[model samples]
Target: MLKQIGNYLKSKWSVRLMTIFYLIAGFNHFINPDFYLPLIPPFFNSHEKINVLSGITEIVLGIGILFYPSRKYASYGIMIMLLAFIPSHVYFIQINSCIDGGLCVPEWAGWFRLVIIHPALLLWAWEAGKSSS
Candidate 1:
């Protein structure tokens, strides 16, 4: 099972799709900061800085994964980043923070973001690792 999973992830298309996903998500940080800003933890103090920092991290990770020499490092970085953000998702759930548009986003949306998207991000990173190998 592990070997099959490894082989499946090694496919070029998997790598390409993961790369595109990372690029899109990273760019979204800059293009739609308001959407994500509400999700940031209160400890960050300044939302703007956190927004910019997230964008920068995303952009860097996206670019790094595409570069041959940095691909492994980038994949690991992305994996770590995804894990790090899990707490913010927890915070969002606890506060029931309304999404940026003022309408209350469904409770499931938070869970989806935390459970689904987060793992997908990790898988994308894993795909990057396979490609780099």
Candidate 2:
């Protein structure tokens, strides 16, 4: 079972899943603005506009990744986007893993996400862009 799962992850289906995941997550930024707004750091200007721009970029890149011609570029874009998001994650940690009126999690979980999950997410995006087939 583990080997099968591993094999599947290396297949094109993994990329498809990543694309769909981003698409839904991106759309959620618009559908539920409240969850995302608090994530933007206080130092950034025009929180609402930044949120909108982020959503649009995610949607565009997510869609762009599906095509053979654009997959590499889109993956790179996703990596860049993830890099751009480091500050937000850091801000989440600074706020003690609990945003006032927004997402709240165990303190360690925030660090775990920043240290572990973020890199894994980047790797996933990188893998999705590769022509492994």
Candidate 3:
């Protein structure tokens, strides 16, 4: 099963699908800024600007990962971006996984995102970097 997963990740279609995923996700930051705004921790000022910047970064890196030459570095950039988001995830957990007037979910669900989904995304990005290289 692990080998099958690896083979799937290494496929060109997987990379393309990842490309589309990030592109849409990045644009969603703009289309639904309110959704992300509440998720931003209070320590960060100018939430609007931060949201724009994050969106732009995601869009740029998403585009960059589509090309063979830039795939590795772009993937690295994505990894860094994900790392930068750790604080927000921690804050979510700290706040009992509920954002007032924002996202509200079970605490365990938040932990699952931080512990499981996040790492899975990292692995996917890493494999994207290696695929077709």
Candidate 4:
């Protein structure tokens, strides 16, 4: 039920799992830079540098979340990071193509990410912060 799921979200293990998810995602930013490059909106002056910095930021936030005392702060950082990526999501919808091509999905998926998935992630980070705090 929803109540049970809510309770689970507040649990410490959930925090740890989410922490690991961030860590892996951050690492992937470096491991698979090519996948991210095309997604960068053309307005940005330095796509490569921005991508690396974002990866580093994620890595640090992941480390922060791994520790109990820093979890709340890290959760907030995660929420902010998610917010920061909103424009890229918008760009994806505008472009209507996969970042590097080959895995193209319908434009609806792009809109879905912005309208639904992004908010869900924000809520997830908010819950994580509240519970960890």
Top lDDT hit:
3
Q: Using lDDT as the measure, what is the rank order of every candidate, best first? A: 3, 2, 4, 1
Off by over 4 Å in 4: 1-3, 100-103
TM per candidate: 0.80, 0.90, 0.93, 0.89
Top candidate, metric TM-score: 3
- Per-residue lDDT of 1-133 in model 1, one digit per residue for the tens? 9667667666666666667776787788889877788788887788888778777787788777777688888889889888878878888877774655653667888789888978866876876675744
User: Candidate 4: global Cα-lDDT?
Assistant: 0.82
The sequence of per-residue lDDT tens digits that candidate 4 reaches over residues 1-133 is: 8767666766778777887888888898899998787888999889999899889988998788777788789889999999899888988888885756544788889889899989877776777776753
lDDT of each: 0.76, 0.87, 0.89, 0.82
Model 2 C-alpha lDDT per residue in residues 61-117, reported as the tens digit of each score: 989888878988998999999999999999999999998777899999999999999
Question: For model 3, which pairs clash?
Answer: none
Candidate 3 residues 1-133, lDDT tens each? 9878877876888888888988998999999999888788899999999899899999999898889999999899989999988888988899999877888999999999999999988988888898884
Candidate 1: regions farther than 4 A off: 1-5, 100-103
Comparing 1 with 2 on lDDT, the higher-scoring candidate is 2
Q: What lDDT score goes with residue 106 in model 3?
A: 96
lDDT for 50 (candidate 4): 84
* TM-score-superior candidate, 1 or 4: 4
